[model samples]
Target: MAEINASDVMKLRKMSGQGMMDCKKALAETNGDLDEAMTLLRKKGLATMAKRADRSASEGKVTVKSSGKDTVLTSLCCETDFVAKNDDFKEVADKVADAALQAAPGSKLAEQEIEGKKVSELITELVSKTGEKTEIGDWAKMSEEENTVVGSYVHFNNKMGALVKIVCENPSEKLQKLADEVCMHIAAVKPMALNKESFDQEVIEKEREIAKEQMKDKPAQIIEKIVEGKINKMISENCLVNQKFVKNEEMTVEEAVKDAGGSKIAAFERVAIG
Candidate 1:
């Protein structure tokens, strides 16, 4: 058996970010071979991740990155808020977001490679280091077309994010600013759909049915009026364009866009890690 020295164990710890005892054990198992010990550590990490597959990773950071016309958002989840706030975890999330932007939108990020290692492997390494379950929760990308502008916003805690694309006949700095404000509104209000037309018909019908149930005792004509009023109110609350703007609550989001110029929201996406 080869002798494992303190120096060798510390070196492996530095290289692998594993605990001192874990590094020492790996080195001892590998007969003091640093390269072999590193591989052993990675294999152990993979095994640990597999064992933790059933654990829920609800706490995480939402990272957003944009270049010119393209924007991407990614949610990197872990088991605890302490790990979520770690600098290394945040850096990993940023790198993952950047890589996701280059790949196809909605690509399986866990299968994609970054710096020669699959992202899932990197996450497994993280789980090993932090002693917590880790995974990628969501991935989304948006791109601007001709005469369109893209904007994004990440919340203060980095747990929520939004992306917005606006189409205009003539795009300008003001219009872009308005689009950014719209993204902020999205992060705050979290509207379900862009407008009444975009809302799912089934969802509308469900809401109508619920309202009818609530007003079952009323006269038929009165119930009809009440149901219509309730449905319209729901649209104003849940539809992005109909919802009141955050900057100026007096006006709806659609009115805000029209007032800023003639631009309209082409698409918007919101992501959150809770």
Candidate 2:
């Protein structure tokens, strides 16, 4: 059998996102065959992650930026809170987000430019300089009518961020204040959907299973009714528009939007530490 070294295990861990000991074990099991070890690790990770899908990812930084009606938001995550707080990490996060705003969704980051440098090159340099693994966690952009202005709230700390695009109906201090409040709420409340109707099919289906399990003792018809009601309740609570307003708690976010009159929230983006 080939000798499995520390460097070999480190390489496998980074490539497969598996635990260090697992990587070492996989290498030993595969007789130090890197490719075979990677495959084993990936398969194992798939199984492990599936079982722990509910694990909360709470270590990440939110970044938001806006240009007119065009807005973008992103999340950058690391292995620990200590790394997330690193100044170098934050700088790289900002640069990556800037590069993302310049590119459209589903495009290659290698093709994007930041400060006249390709993002791919920047990533390489940053990794070497920081001595830490860095990857772009998420990227999203929103745009409205060209004439309208985009507003952003990056929050008190780098912990959370938001971008709000407004459509001209009219711009007033009141409207801006309302928009700011909405952004703050996004960071604090973390709604999973924009409206009840907008919940993803997969999310609904998963919730349906949970509801059925919870109401299993009831009559079949009653169980289904209960499941449907549970799904609706989840939508109202998890969706932004239907959620109770974070600021007031008495009104739904939708009500606040309607009260804003002519001004409309064309789009919004929010992210928090994982």
Candidate 3:
């Protein structure tokens, strides 16, 4: 066995966030090679994480990042609220979200490599530190198209977030600011879809069926009218543009967007950790 120095062990501990004993063991196992020791420690973390695969990670954090043209949101989950509040856990979530902003639009976050390390490997390192299951819960990326702007928000608790992409004949800083406010509304109001057209047809059919059941005692002619009213009400409540604005409840989100400068919602995505 190669002689392991205290300095090398401490450096490895700092690099891997592993305990001093584990770092020393890794260093001795790798023959005092720092790079090799790091690799070995990460492999150990990966193994530990696999053993914790069945554990529930119900508490987590949400992070958001944007590059003007692209916005990304990611949720990193852990087994407890204490881990979720740890500085290390928060740092890893921010790194994951930043990497997501730069990743290929359709790429999977866990599979993507950042600076030669797989994203899942990073999460595994965190799992080793916390001694609990940790993983990426959800990820979303929204890109700004021609004549469009992207905005994002992460809630104060860091447990909910949103991204919005808007299209306009005239995109300006004011419109971008509106996009941000809309993102907050999204996080709070939890709209199901952008509009009636973007909503799922299957869900709409189910809603119609539900309405029919609720009014079975009514005449058939009145039932259609009642169903129409119910469907319209559903659109007003569940659709993003049609829903009442969270900032000012008197106006719909659609009206808010238009009042901001005739911008339309191109896309929106929300992420939450429970």
Candidate 4:
């Protein structure tokens, strides 16, 4: 049997992100062949992932990247908060977001490449290093035309983020400020859609049904009126343009945009990690 030196073990650990003991064992098993040892470590990581496939990975970070008229948001989820906050983990998420932004709007980041390796492979290495189930949760991209402006906000803890694109004839400083405020509102309120028109009819009808069940004791006409009122209120709450502005409660977000300069939200995306 070939002898594995400490330097060889450290080199393998650095390359594979595996534990020192594991790297040493792999090196010994591979007769000090670094490439073969790396393959062995990756296989072990994949096996670990398979064994923990049923576990929940809700804790992670949301990363955002913007360039020109495009903004991308990506979520990298892990099994625990400690791993989520790790420097290596954050570096991986940032790189993934950057790659996703450069690719097509809805392209899968995992299928993309980073540093000559597929992102999925890098994630497997991360799992091997962190000993946790890790995966990408969401990837959203928003693009605007030349006459439009894009704004984004990432919450303090990096767990939530939002991006908004506003279409305006003239992109002035005030219009940009309004767009930023709307993006912040999205990060805070978490609206379901831009407006009532965009909401799913099926969801609205289901809400109406639930409201009818709750008010069954009332008169038929009264029940209809109450159900309509409830559905309208729900729409107002879930629609971004209908929700009251956070900075100025007196006006809705739509009103604020119009007051600022008649800008309208063209698109928006919000990503959160639980």
Candidate 5:
């Protein structure tokens, strides 16, 4: 077997993005062969992921990467905030986002590869280093086309964000600005759905049931009106288009979208982790 020097281990660390000890061990196993060490590291990642399969990974960052007229939102979730904040974890997440962006729209992000390694393999490597569960979470991709505007926002903490695409007769800087503002609004408001039509029907019925119970003492006619009023108010608050505009309280997001180029919010997705 060849000698494994400190420099060779460091080189493997850079190449595999695994921890120092892992790099050293891989080098030893590979007889100081850099390429073989990298392969060993990736294979180890799979075992590590399987070992920690039951761990709950609830924390991480949402990455919104944009290139030209396209944008991809991807999240890397880990077992704790400490691991989520780790520099290596963040770098891997960014790489995943980049790979997702490069792949065809709607591609399964975990299947995408860097060099010869699948993204899922890369994540398992980090799981081994951190001793924490790590996996990809919510993701979305958007490609802008004629007569449309795209906007996206990732909160300062990077734990939550939104991406929005709007349709207009003629896209412009002004409309784009509104779309950006709406993305921020989405981050702040965290709407449940684009509109009431899309809101979960069972949830809607449940709300109506709750309202009926609350007003059960009133006359049937009065109770009926009160229940409907409460349901409408609840829908308005939860639906994205019906929710009050976060920037200007005077209008609903629907009105705001209309005011900016007589447009409609064509598509949106909000991604978050806790």
Candidate 6:
């Protein structure tokens, strides 16, 4: 048996982007042979993925699979965007998103299967074939029965993606237009929540403190009103539904959703490639 030194382990880690324990184990399994260790790690990833494969993937391609009110929008990531567009990569993405649709209600990634292979094993297979790392980044599953309608926005460069799930009544042309506008808004504004109530209490408190400091020198009688006004403004500015529409300033997102056709946004998703 050959001695596997620290440098050899580091080299393997750099080449594989695998965990330290995994790299060391691979080295021992291969009798300190670097090439053999790499191969071992690859095989190990496939086997391990088979058991706990439904992990949240952080990199890959963003794909949309929809049929009327039932839809699935997912982002599958690879070590590089180059591989993300590969035919094989796209095929895997389609399969996963399709699986997500066919998967049991409320089934998560770990529970879904793609073409007889576990989700994780499929990802490892792609990694092995493309010579790059791959994983699922994010996903949105919508159903009318669940009161969720999907609106997707794919970045012009195809490097990033986003999905917005709207819960509105009797979606009309205007509502569809509004949904599309909201998708654009998500691309631009990037709000943290839908409204003030959805904001973290600590975050709200922090902003309140900041506003209070800005009005500290004001008359005490007016300070309370000032703080209240600032808090409202801050919440409106940060919440997606409260902010004025980017395309039409006359209406806020909340109003737009309603006036567009008596509908309201239910949920949303977004993605970007590094």
* Lowest-sum lDDT 10-residue window in model 5: 39-48
What TM-score does prediction 4 earn?
0.94
Q: How would you encode candidate 6's per-residue C-alpha lDDT over 214-239 as one tens digit per residue?
A: 98999989998988898788777989
Q: Which residue pairs come into collision in candidate 6? A: 54-110, 57-136, 59-77, 60-76, 60-77, 60-78, 61-76, 163-269, 165-267, 167-266
* Model 5, span 1-274: residue lDDT tens: 8898999988888887777888888888889989998878777777778887898778898999999888988889988888888998988899998888888866787899986878887787777678787888888888899988889899998888889999889988888888989999998888988887788889889999999998999998799899999988888888899888998989998899889884788889888886
Give the local distance difference test score of model 3: 0.86
Off by over 4 Å in 3: 28-40, 219-221
Report per-prediction Cα RMSD to one decimal: 2.1, 10.0, 2.2, 1.6, 2.5, 8.8
Candidate 5 stretches with Cα past 4 Å from truth are 1-11, 29-36, 103-107
**Residue pairs in steric clash, candidate 2?**
68-150
Q: In model 5, which residue pairs have backbone atoms overlapping below 3 Å? A: none
Against the true structure, what is each candidate's TM-score? 0.91, 0.69, 0.89, 0.94, 0.87, 0.67
Identify the leading candidate in terms of lDDT. Answer: 4
Better of 3 and 6 by lDDT: 3
Using TM-score as the measure, name the better of candidate 2 and candidate 5: 5
lDDT of 3 by residue, 115-214 (tens): 7877888887887778888888878998878888788888998889898988899888888888899999999989989988888889889999999999
Residue 164 lDDT (model 4): 88
Alpha-carbon deviation at 143 in model 2, angstroms: 2.9
- Mind giving the per-residue lDDT tens digits that candidate 4 earns over 188-209? 9999989988998999999999
**Poorest lDDT segment (10 consecutive residues) of candidate 3:** 105-114
Ranking by TM-score: 4, 1, 3, 5, 2, 6
